[model samples]
Target: MVDDTLLETRHLTKEFAGFVAVNDVSLRVRRGTIHALIGPNGAGKTTVFNLLTRFLPATHGQILYRGEDITHARPAEVARRGLVRSFQISAVFPNLTVLENVRVALQRKLGTSFHFWQSERSLDALDERATELLAQVDLASHRELLAVELPYGRKRALELATTLALEPELLLLDEPTQGMGHEDVGRVTALIQRVARDRTVLMVEHNLSVVADLSHVITVLARGSVLAEGPYADISRDRQVLEAYIGSAEPEAAV
Candidate 1:
């Protein structure tokens, strides 16, 4: 792997029974850049995510992170090594206050054991860092609200805060703007751009506008294979990409 590459997948393949979901895919994510994986639904975008995060084991191929092969690393192990995935839904604990959700994640990152009997002061030490994370995602104002009470956009912001608390070197986001209103989409788009400044982000986003705006590189997948790969402008013009979305809502590739 090149020093500039944060992640690479070599001949990455996944099979379910006899179906090949991702077939011999090789990907390189440059350090400190935002890369997007876009395709029409069922193009194996999420399956690729599952393989990378080890949510599902790859049938074949290798996953390399920071030049180290982690093909067989467990999900927790991958997360511990600084590759973290944000689920499709916000992963915040609904009953916990926004501040507490981030605090708990920070504690987990620090390898602090849960101690029901521990003094409150130990947890208080986390407030400063947690507040900083919340501020990073523009959730500082809602720190006192329960996670369940946040509006959809704010809840997603809270989820991003918790993900950031892990201090991941590589972040995988699944449909960050899905189900969001236009206003919320713009906000999260800006938030993603801000957080990705110092880390590598690989995201699967259905919103082509957001992908075009934020992606330094875009890879288009079709039928479990890479159909096109390049800057947003170039991939947008690829004839193969346009045809792949023909009968469905177009990918807005021209964006």
Candidate 2:
């Protein structure tokens, strides 16, 4: 039988000077499942992401992708290995049209990322695949618009489109729905669901509604440690999760 785990962290820890941001956290993300890392303020959720992506070197621990230890992998190396991430803020180029932005991402796979000086016709081959990605995120009609002109929710969709252009095996999303009203939240949530159908996703999200809807497994962190781990059904009733995260209105707004 094949091993189903796609990503795993063992004894992961990160420190800043003398401050412990993430403390000995170990997690396993099974293949093709949506896993959410959630917590209240200062729970070290983003710190864990930084560690996983190799933005910060771990003080102690291990990061494993497909069962290989990757504790010291560089950010670019990690991304090249089929693990990609989207940010909390919109990351598309403001002046570029949605199609152009996605086409730029596709250029990475062709090994011509800095060839913008080339003829426009040279990159036209990517247009068809770019359009398919746009349609996947429901942004096909907005393909001609500059990314800056899109509404915030639509901008996020375009960013997702660009990320998909890289063909990631495991997508890491940081607060994908932050700062959105109910309508945009619903749209992005559905978009995440659609995109997650083919690959695995690990996200740090504050919105319980989105976490409840999409997460197959939920990990709760508190004070830089794992406080709970289980499905949403079990996590919802976890007394510690309720007291530390869900019971407070402010926590829902946390990043």
Clashing residue pair totals per candidate (backbone < 3 A): 0, 0
Candidate 2 local lDDT, 58-79, one digit each (tens):
9999999999988998999999
Per-residue CA lDDT of model 1 for 49-168, tens digit only, reads: 999999999999999999999999999999999999998988889999999999989888556757768786889989999999999999899899999999999999999999998899
What pairs collide in candidate 1? Answer: none
The TM-score measured for candidate 2 stands at 0.97
Candidate 1 structure, TM-score to reference: 0.96
Candidate 1: C-alpha lDDT: 0.91
Candidate 2 clashes between residue pairs 3 or more apart in a chain or in different chains: none
